[model samples]
Target: MHDDPRLEELVKQVRASRKYSAISEALVRRIGAAELCKRATLQDAVKATKKTLHQIAGLYLANAHPPYDAWLRQIIQAPDDTARRAVLRSIMNHHTSTRERLPILDAFYARVLADLGPVRSVLDLACGLNPLSLPWMPLAAGATYHAVDIYEDLAGFLRAALAALGVAGKAEARDVITDCPTDAADVALLLKALPCLEQLDKAAGAAILDTINARCIVVSFPTRTVGGRQVGMRENYAARFAAMIADRPWRVERIEFVGELAFRLTR
Candidate 1:
């Protein structure tokens, strides 16, 4: 796709920004190619690409390039699981999405994922620091966890954090919208991800739901905006999610928390 000189140049320009440099090349190319098609010139495409990137990801991060190496070292040197969980929570607080979920972190996973008994494997797509909540989840012995995100640095940090926690899984930097993972798993977690994904492509939500290979999928949406405004988002997202899965044969169960709304779809 980058074969076109214009597209290649667009990708370079978009990634040139320190804020977007760590995003996967696949995602950069995907959005850049689309922008190149719509915009009249390479500069226009580059500007549009950065705007889209900020909407989909940058806005959620408190810092574009977090101190992942330092966080990793903190996790590695923690005295026990309790200490590690504290470090993980601190790291998660840097992202708006995860920070909001912190209030209910202790019960969020247990209640939402309980129906899928004995979770042995999981696929977390567009995962930010949510994977750090592994301590709160109930997993079977030797369970494998697979998580993917567009940020290369964050993905690397998650990979090392998982290893440090003695969990069995791999975290990778992937543009799931373009390259969805096909690995079969007991459950797939799309926590507060669909809305952000739709910012890039309107059909991304349905596309991801259709492609993920899992027996159960737990999808969540924020009930309030980042600024703590309640604007009927709950009702809006509930209806939107209903429409998104209206054609499927899966059984859906709705779960609501203080600031988050979730649905469990079982096939």
Candidate 2:
């Protein structure tokens, strides 16, 4: 019997949460039917049960990442274009502010787009709300802008955003893990997505780089953890990222920002 006061309080809170109560009951039913391990203390037993129930309903843990779905819901309900734009900006990751993310975006149009030779097409992969930042990307006339994400809701909102912003672009929902992206564009943006992809599958990041046909691919990673901890994450990701693309003959141009590490990989 582990008589921890902290454990007792945690169990009480979980029991009181309506969202978790049904899930907890389902778990207890399974455990009881299977004759699972017994805890001497009832409170301790509840705490352990709560943890198992939480894992079973882990989809509710969307609170950990960017609130994209919630923001999208709010956007659809917003009254006007201005209000929708505000909702869209609210979901931008911590790297960027509610308005413009970083100072680099000011010169981004000139640096990435204009300097990349003839970019009549752009492909944004695992692109969150970046298409909303089209104002920052000074694309030439009649350029085909394509964005992709896993969530269908994101695709719907992004397509609406593009039309509202008067940008000639299309957004598609895709599961990059299962299906490979077949879009061909002059420039592809894979911003802060490698680490996330790697978490699902170890070789997915490299596979995506190889599959996407783009003359110039711009890849980025966060310099610090979401908690703002610079615990050697930058150097670690940098080394692995560089090694991942080393096989290809990519002329990598590195850009170091306070929040993110970016590379413009071209042949």
Candidate 3:
């Protein structure tokens, strides 16, 4: 597909848009190629690809150019963990998905990670600003975290933030659907990520779950729309999640919060 001049032009057009310029080129190319297969014309493919990009990522970011440098300076200058958490909370509010979880942040990690004793490593996929919640997780001393997202800038910010928080890990801009991370970890976090992944590929949720190398995987879904309307998303997503894991042998446990539904799969 890369050899096709039409597909190449489609990717260039999509990336030329200011709104999508920072997205992972791998993701843009992947979505653009798929759109080309379905659309009748290059213009149509570009339009469809942009729409999908907005749904999967653009809508979540309140600020396209967040002051990561300033945030890092604040984190490093802060006197203690409380001060660092305050700065992290402010940064997280910039993402709609993470903002919605603020109300439940205190108990969210505790409940989901409670059973897993002394987590030494984590793999956070489609991570967004979720890694900022590291201060609240029950991590062992010198725990390592690996986070991945499609936005290059976000991944860069996360990489620096991880260092500032004194955690050892790496973050990268990756198209998780096309190239899911294979690194082994004690726990893998797919928090509210399946729905977004499925938006790109119907089988993405199951594919990632099957391929991720972790002893336990934590998956979550938003129970409300971005507009804050409750339309039985909890029930809908729960049923879908059940179907995804029904054939697997991993034991499953369900947990529900104010605006999210989560499931923990242990192998």
Candidate 4:
């Protein structure tokens, strides 16, 4: 933290924004001057709580995907007016709960860690701003972790987060659909980041899904509903994903749909 005037300015801006009052309050409470001092060198408590905050942020948005979806649709079709940027930023600022992410992570750990011997590597796909799976690094023990994402900001964040957590990993900005490296791993985790929506084109998504054939694949997606309507306005992607893998050597061991997302852990 080290008394960053920049963060101070961000806090001020967040508080001053009328639309971001709730987030402003939460952000202010989460980082005080003293906490900021400790955050710089990656103090134990700050690191741990920031880790938790990261999870909270993901679940927060995952829960809001439904309303967020409607908001996005309206913005996309809003005639490209001056209000578009404001609307999009507001939608992006929406948050998710950390409580929800833990349960899903716990379940994933339970299933994957079972009888996992000599597990020494991981390939994480579409790692977002927080790299939700970074918390599992220690548990991964002697493994080398590699993460890829389309967002350079997120990839950089993953590098920083892992460094702060005292874990080693490599992260790169690459299209998950086009730049999957030749290297393989004992496990591949795709935490709610299956590029299905981004692709939009069924053929492209199918190709992306086809390339992944790790010993284990953890696929998660926004569930069927958020504010009563499906998050993606459709639930067919789950079936489509299944169809893509039907003839592969892998087998779907479990499929759990929670909140606005679903988790599929297959082997």
Which pairs of residues collide in candidate 1? none
Writing each residue's lDDT as its tens digit, candidate 2 over 76-118 gives 6878867765655555542232123444555654665657766
Give TM per candidate.
Answer: 0.97, 0.66, 0.97, 0.54
What is the Cα-based lDDT of residue 17 in candidate 1? 88
In candidate 4, what are the lDDT values of residues 89-117, reduced to their tens digit?
34434433223354455454555445545
lDDT of 3 by residue, 1-267 (tens): 666689888888988888898899999998988888899989999999999999999889897667788887988898987888898899899898899999999999999999788899999999999999999898899999999999888889889889988899999999999899998999999998899999989999999999999999999999999999999999999999898889998999999899999899999
lDDT at position 77, candidate 4: 61
What are the candidates' C-alpha RMSDs?
Answer: 1.1, 9.5, 1.1, 18.1
The segments of candidate 4 whose C-alpha lies over 4 angstroms from its true place after superposition are 1-103, 130-132, 136-138, 195-200, 224-235, 260-267
RMSD of 4: 18.1
Give candidate 3's whole-model lDDT.
0.91
Please give the CA lDDT of all the candidate structures: 0.92, 0.65, 0.91, 0.50
Order of candidates by lDDT, top first? Answer: 1, 3, 2, 4
Clash number by candidate, in order = 0, 1, 0, 14
